[model samples]
Target: MPPSRNYMTERLPSPQLLLRINTLRDRALAADSLNALAFSMANDAYSLLQYHQALVLALQGEQAELLCVSGLAKPAEDSPYLVWLKRAGRWLNQQLDGNQPVWLARADLDPPADINDGWAEWWPAGLWCVPLHNRAGQRLGLVLFLLDAPPPAPLPELLSSLWQTWSYCWQALDSKRRLPRWNASRSKLLIGLGVLLLLLLIPVRQTVLAPAEIVSREAQIISSPIDGVIKQMHVRPNQQVETGSLLFTLDETTLRNRAEVLSKGVAVADAELLAASQRAFDNPQSKGELTLLNGRAQQSRAELAAVKAQLARTQVHAPKAGIAVYSDPNDWLGKPVSTGERILQVADPAQPAMRIQLAVADAIALEPGAKVTLFLTAYPLTPLHGEVLETSYQAHPSDEGVSSYRLLASIEGEPENARLGLHGTAKLYGERVLLGYYLLRRPLAAVRAWTGW
Candidate 1:
């Protein structure tokens, strides 16, 4: 009889046994753990083979094949069963397109005849092979088995069920391996793009935006005109004043008294001169007396004028229209002011200007009317636009151990509240040239000067 007829002749499982098998199948299907599902399938296959007097094996793929044998004995590395597994892997790769299942019997097992001589003594009589495919329908591994003796009948339904369960386990394992690699590749790509964008933005900022502006030190001091006591101050600190506005008064009481005494002497000299002139005209012999009196009167008048002028200068006035700034007074209030001592500053608020100190080398290349942009520490948000108004022909020594030219620029649209001596920096645009010239100009100039190239 054929194997199919023999399998049918065997009695069908009892209802109770059928119910238990169904329960185990349901539990395996609902299992959340992939390992649990794999082990459950392996155990079920083992039980069925034992009851039916056969052998079974399960296989998983790594770099090499892993075989879980359920038979009369465990196979050694050189055993016939392991040799069959290696051959099965090669055959499955060729015939299955690495997908689907392949079943084998005595006629199907095609090991070399010489190798099979030992297999007849130690190996099982029957063989079954199933290819394990993932969800993508790619072969992940193979499952194989050998029976202790030829199965009483071919169990096609059992083999089909085993193939289905093995496929699910392989798919779960493949999913776990592939997801992390995909996520890592995606993350690296995004990070690289972000860094590239930041690098691209750097040059735009350097070329289009203005830099900070600075003021030179020499343009900011206020000095006194003469030596005298500061008797009264007419203006407060930071007050705005026009040219000739009185700022303070010095002690002038003594000068005023001297002026009054000179005035009385001038009056007496004038009366004497008038009397002498009248007498000279009335009597010719009085001519010498008239000349002496006239000389005396003229000298008295000159003295009076000198004393009056001295008194007038005792009050101090502004030299220019601007915002007044008092420097460190050094607590000198009500004290005498010496000649040329700086008392306060009067900065031109309406026509505010900035000074740039350029190195002698840089200054030589700069010409008047070159563009400049100024940035003050106090007003960082707005830039003061201007052009080089003037450049000193002579260079002055600087703290940087080099000589520099003082370049002046008139600040455009002077701010309403900008004070004198506010700290700032200036960037000179120098001369216009081509983009290529801009890049090579500095280096070439330096090399030519250094090596005569």
Candidate 2:
């Protein structure tokens, strides 16, 4: 058999204990309406537990103040209970480490000394101190009930359970007050990521855009056949001419004079030869003289023939059908040209190409057949398309005093209204690549060059 049980040690709640617990739970659940909830909890606790008063002191960071008061019609700031609460707050914070409710019985304060303004003398016979904490273990505040007698065991346990749930609601209210509604840094980070993704997905042509000009695809240069002074001009600068058209005539005054002189010399030699032949027929010793006279005549005739040929070539003719590409015609009218010296160019206007001078700094690796589009200064609204045919192996200084490489591009077809020497800009398209790579290629190249990395 079991020993006789000690019923006095295990106290039970009264019949109305469940009703009081339910009422407190309802108040705690409505903690979002904090002021009303605090008042309701305080009044209900006072009436249900038969306490002298109920008080809720809210604590936020380092601040502590009375939230609500019950069981007093005219509660004053100088009230002993409030004064005692203010004085004991620091001690209460240190003792409520685990956030468990502190059940203070009448026997516990027997030897208590005076507190703030001697408010310790007004201490209740028994009290319940429930320290409220959120689920994360952050202290919300403290709830105090001034007890007329020790509360039933179930009442303190029930209040502790209700406050635990109420702690969450209080936390929500605190967060709403302390935390920002929108975070600028978070928003900025999202925007930056979106821009990066957009840039990666978008595509653009990887092209090297440079200035260009329209030029003859293939030109024929006319040069002087012999050293002579220009005596006559048959064509104007930039004028179109057909094959065999006389282009220019060199001075022929001295040439004609030399030819006439040589002719007279030949005539004199022939007369001498005839006389020598007659003598040779009369005397055998005169045969050598005939041979000498004949040789002299032959030499004079050869010299005369050469002079006539020179006179004929004095009038230069067009080699092919094309425009006379030269500066002012007056520049050549009285000019003396050396043998093989270039006089002008005959370029077919129908066949046009692009000549580009790419700066060394702006140059990129290029392959044959690169597509190029030209926008002429004279026709900005029009564009001419072509393909790269050749590129210089080395760079040369341009008129602008910058080192550049020259490239030749053939037009896809004969462009309407296009002419030789038409100047414009060109865009040379290269292999496809990412937009970021295309944009940063130059800057990265510069950095590498500067750092030698």
Candidate 3:
């Protein structure tokens, strides 16, 4: 019907060719399934190893191991790699004690030459050891993986992502274990003993007396004297300055000009005085002229001196040695300033002091020269010795609706670095009451006031 197809143009496949394609397809499918299974197993093993590593590290143990289904032999004890592992174990222990994560790299591992010889060809060169922590966050052991050469690439990625699961599992196991229970019991027992000791020592503290701190005068705010364009600023914010030292200079062009004019006027006045005296000696009638010249010379000299004195005020000098604190300029630059506009403040570091606002009732009990302890927020450990220098007699209403008196205290032996405006607590040592009263006074007062009891 198709005009008979030519034998040379048509072709047919032999049965052997069909069989070969089917066989190749079967092999490919099998290989894929095997790879997937191997990857899954590797991931599981890695997770377990990580957990064990963490446990050993937390315990400060010198050894850790990750056992697998393959029944790999333990590393040789004498091997350098083994030594490295021991070091890592020690590091892990330290980290755990410090409550930090145990992170060890391939460089941390000491391996036997032959140990990796078998797997060297199959695995990456550099391996990492990750510690696994139990539910109690205790080190379990380690998870090992070859970083340089990963198996199938995807396997390593999968293992790394799933490694956290091992930590969770181990942590659960630790929680269910008996070791934690024993530790907790021991801790409670120690706490109970401590409480008993504290109760017994209460009376002993009453017998011993400590040197009382004396409250001193509060620091005063040092304000700037003059305002002008700050030509030369010598000190920075909080920089210590000395008395008579140059703090800064104002634009003194106007003053400099006045000084120059006064200097010329003084020279002219001196010549006129000399000439007038010579003429008075030469002629009797010149006496009147000489007297007039003398008066004019004296007036010119006085004016010149006054102008020079005014010029000296242009250079800003420190009034006292202290720290320099700059005030906000408020967008003013080279602008003229009022007579008392502050440019900077110098706080005396050596004479550190603090001001406290106390309730009027508390202030009534506080007397001048009373001892007090100052505890700055910045230096909580170091209590500053202080004495009550002064207390305001008048009670003023505070923003908090409380009538308070300002109490000034001079801090003794302050550190060189202490700055102004540092907030601190001042504990005033009121008249020495019974040791028992001193200890419970604050709490009792608060309770009495709160409960109206």
Candidate numbers sorted by TM-score from highest down: 2, 1, 3
> What TM-score number comes out for model 1?
0.42
* Ranked candidates, highest lDDT first: 2, 1, 3
lDDT of 1 by residue, 20-85 (tens): 556556756675665455445545565455532222233343333544344333348786557765
- Once model 2 is optimally superposed onto the true structure by TM-score, how far is the C-alpha of residue 128 displaced, in angstroms? 62
Score each candidate by Cα lDDT: 0.62, 0.79, 0.54
Error of 3 at 394 (Å): 4.0
**Higher-lDDT candidate among 1 and 2?**
2
- What's the true lDDT of residue 265 in model 2? 100
Model 2, 6-31: lDDT tens per residue?
A: 45435655657667677677766766
Give the worst 10-residue stretch by lDDT in candidate 1: 203-212
Please identify model 2 stretches exceeding 4 Å from their true place: 1-204, 394-403, 434-437, 440-453
Cα RMSDs, all models: 17.8, 20.1, 23.3
Q: Best TM-score goes to which candidate?
A: 2
Candidate 3 achieves a global lDDT of 0.54
Poorest stretch of ten by lDDT in candidate 2: 111-120
